[model samples]
Target: MARLGIVALLAAFGLILTATSSPAASTLRAAAAEKNIVIGTAVATGPLAGETAYRTTVAREFNSLTAENAMKWDTVEPSPNSFNWSGGDAVVNFAAANGQRVYGHTLVWHSQAPSWVQNLSAADLLPAMRNHITKVMQHYSTVDS
Candidate 1:
């Protein structure tokens, strides 16, 4: 009788472990989906392209992505009218491939603005900012947010 009780207890424990240890049960993306919430992380372009582990984690865990620095003004528009869309595009492409949404970080921030933007006179600042926003939005029109 004692032997049967021990076997039953062991089986119960095993069943509990199996229920909790499933990949879908443990993943943030899946949990968020259950609650209709969006879980996201900031992705750095360098590791995103170079590290398999980073990419795997991002794809497995998050439903949305925000570029760490790649979407910042300094990185995207280092020079006026000379945009570099590579870094931002990499993030968008990865998000699309993973069935994840892309969240645009910022188009205008005091900290990450390029030198030319920073040096713009008061009269020139608004137009430059407007232009920057227009161009960036047009480029990333496909992003979810």
Candidate 2:
């Protein structure tokens, strides 16, 4: 009966995963409202812009959204002077349209960073970090408010 128990446990686990992953309209928002908590999820800008189902589900279910990768160091500012805001803008615009709040994923992290950041010396690191923050903040300032 040990083998049968394992199979039953796996089936129950699968059901739990499916139930948690399934999207429901205002489910998160409703739950959060009851407890005065905010529900949020990490998302990619491109998918929300391209996929109607994803955009609709995210906008309807969660009250807050965060860009999964668009705002990261490697993604937004790849090189020294080159900054890309296309993906970031998409996320911001979508959030605005859906009346959803946006939380900045992260500013500094070891992972998903470019080589320039990885190779920075002690003296240069602060300056680079400041510049990155300044530029990113400036770009999102209008949308943030």
Candidate 3:
């Protein structure tokens, strides 16, 4: 009876070890890949850059990512003819490093639009929109879709 109890305990310990051994075995990315599906999430550049847990979860569980606020018009181009691509670039680079595809979020959304853009004249609005869209798209041309 003593030998049988030891064997049962050892088997239980083995099962626990196997269950906790590999995190990737239960990842959403792996499960999605099995079904020919792409799992993705919207990522904020702040947490992605600063938080190890956030970055690890994003990379481990998702096969694709979209910039949450990084790609917005207000964030990318806060002033007329001026651009800041750092946040957006960070997201794209992270995705690339993790073998994940990037989904471009938005070029011209009314919400979170810059004050300069909102104040543009009708004639100037179209040109400004075109310029913003063209520049953003060109910058991320190398990103995987």
TM-score: which candidate is best?
1
TM-score, each model?
A: 0.82, 0.74, 0.81
Query: Which clashing pairs does model 1 show?
Result: none
Please give the TM-score that candidate 3 achieves against the real structure: 0.81
RMSD of each: 11.4, 8.2, 11.5
Per-residue C-alpha lDDT of model 1 across residues 88-128, encoded as one tens digit per residue:
99999999999999999778999999988767899998988
Deviating ranges (above 4 Å) for candidate 2: 1-26, 142-145
Looking at candidate 3, what is the lDDT of residue 17?
52
Candidate 1 accuracy as TM-score: 0.82
The reply for model 3, stretches above 4 Å from the true place, is 1-25
Expressed as tens digits, the lDDT of each residue in 1-145 for candidate 2 is 3224334544554565567756533355665666777766677766677767677767766677778899998998899858998888888888888878887857778897777787789898888888988898988885432
- On lDDT, the leading prediction is 1
Superpose all Cα atoms of candidate 3 onto the true structure and report the RMSD in Å to 1 decimal: 11.5
Error of 3 at 45 (Å): 0.8
Sort the candidates on lDDT, descending order: 1, 3, 2
